[model samples]
Target: MPTALNRRSLSSLAVTAAAAALLAGGATAANAVPAAGGATAQHRACHVHALSDGRGAEVCRTWTPHGDGTYYGTWQVDRADANVIAQGRFDGKVRNLGVQGSYSRVKDFVTRACDSSGKRCSSWA
Candidate 1:
């Protein structure tokens, strides 16, 4: 009974809702855990977003056993883009990784993955 356009709109809305829920859940989980030395850690779960080339990229923040915060990222190959980039930034510090890489240092508050030329980017987490 629904038109094609209506269906597409509904689908898009569903995806957006799902993404929002995922982000909310991730934030809650991160807040509930206590970091090392009794400090609160800011960690986020992986979030996948579609790129312009139809590929996808994922960005995530993780806490080590010792409570060190790290950034993790992975992206699929897009023939149009030479390389995929993932960056995590916090407190004026930025760390970068490419095509399935994770930073070894503990420094991150937000994370995002992008395709070449920043054609497509994921929502910050």
Candidate 2:
């Protein structure tokens, strides 16, 4: 026979374990590829437009997937001078027709520009 406190502790442990398992299953499901022509085919590569400082906006070229929807690309800004910006490897996903991902620059040129302008910016630096 166990005390009420012991039963409560066991119940709490069981609940925690169940929650962890559920979360792991959910993560696996999210990464799983759906049936072809069903939903996976509808997932497009993620893209981001070039940032403009109002002088003239830059044009971002199309990016192609490297592997498993991950992409690597580059964009050139031809405003004051020709500047090349490279986007490193990034993970892409599609959820309900919406594409999202995390992208980082291979270099710190963008952040340097922002910092020079005295504007607060977030970067890997």
Candidate 3:
């Protein structure tokens, strides 16, 4: 019993709703990626330096991956000829300060150190 104008409006509404539902379903199916628990891997790295007599020295460096968007590694430096351990975490590609409580935003640990300390350090990229 609707008017012709009302019928047209309802038809358009139904078409819009159908299109929206189709688009939503398509996006859900197409945008799916492997879960973090799956076979995907993530990696990150960083550098540590010890300063003595206003000079920075590299002690030790390493890079490791946990393959699930997490990483753990260690770096050592000699300040006054004593080893200083820097343990840190990498969230995918971002390095979080582990025991040192200092986060590095650089993609690689060594380049991150270069950006942080203004020194020529090796790259872990």
Candidate 4:
């Protein structure tokens, strides 16, 4: 009978430890911000710049949710900019593109937009 009781006590202790671990993990997940495709969208900030020639540029910086250590950016231009960089249908024209960083720093994937004249540009996002 004593051996059976000891086994029962050990089993109860193991279950309690597992439950505590699960609770701790749940609390951490609850505090995290939702991802982009989740119920809540990732936070973002936008900026627009115009040139003397009546052309404009726009850029946005999107922060990653918790557990991700990087950020992303998007850019658009009404005309064209000499310094604008993009691929596949983007040429500083009236188009926008989303870019992400492979590393942990936002600067790893900075985006720039400029007017047609190339003299004016939106700050890197």
Which stretches of model 4 miss by more than 4 angstroms?
A: 1-41, 65-68, 72-109, 117-120
Of 2 and 3, the candidate ranking higher by TM-score:
2
Of the pair 1 and 3, which is ahead by lDDT? 1
Considering summed lDDT, which 10 consecutive residues are worst modelled in model 2?
1-10
- Pairs with steric clashes in candidate 4: 80-115
Superior candidate under lDDT, 2 versus 4: 4
- Please give the distance, in angstroms, between residue 78's alpha carbon in candidate 3 and its true position after superposition: 2.8
Position 62, candidate 1: lDDT: 42
Cα displacement (Å) at residue 27, model 4: 23
lDDT of 2 by residue, 12-88 (tens): 33344445656767422112324334432111121222335422122222222333444333333222212323222
lDDT of 2 at 34: 41
Give the per-residue lDDT of model 1 (tens digit) for 25-114: 742223244444664433324555456665655544343323343433222212223455765554448555544444444344455667
TM-score, every prediction: 0.42, 0.25, 0.24, 0.32
TM-score, predicted candidate 4 vs. hidden true structure: 0.32
Worst 10 contiguous positions by lDDT, candidate 1: 1-10
Error of 1 at 71 (Å): 11
Please give the lDDT score at residue 28 for candidate 1: 28
Q: Which whole-number lDDT from 0 to 100 does residue 70 have in model 4?
A: 39
Ranked by TM-score, top first = 1, 4, 2, 3
Give the residue spans of candidate 1 off by over 4 A: 1-27, 34-44, 64-82, 98-108
Q: Measure candidate 3: CA RMSD.
A: 20.8
Predicted candidate 3 versus true structure: per-residue lDDT over 1-125, tens digit per residue: 00001111222333444456567664221112223345322222222343333333332333233444333344433221223222222433434232333233322343122224333322232
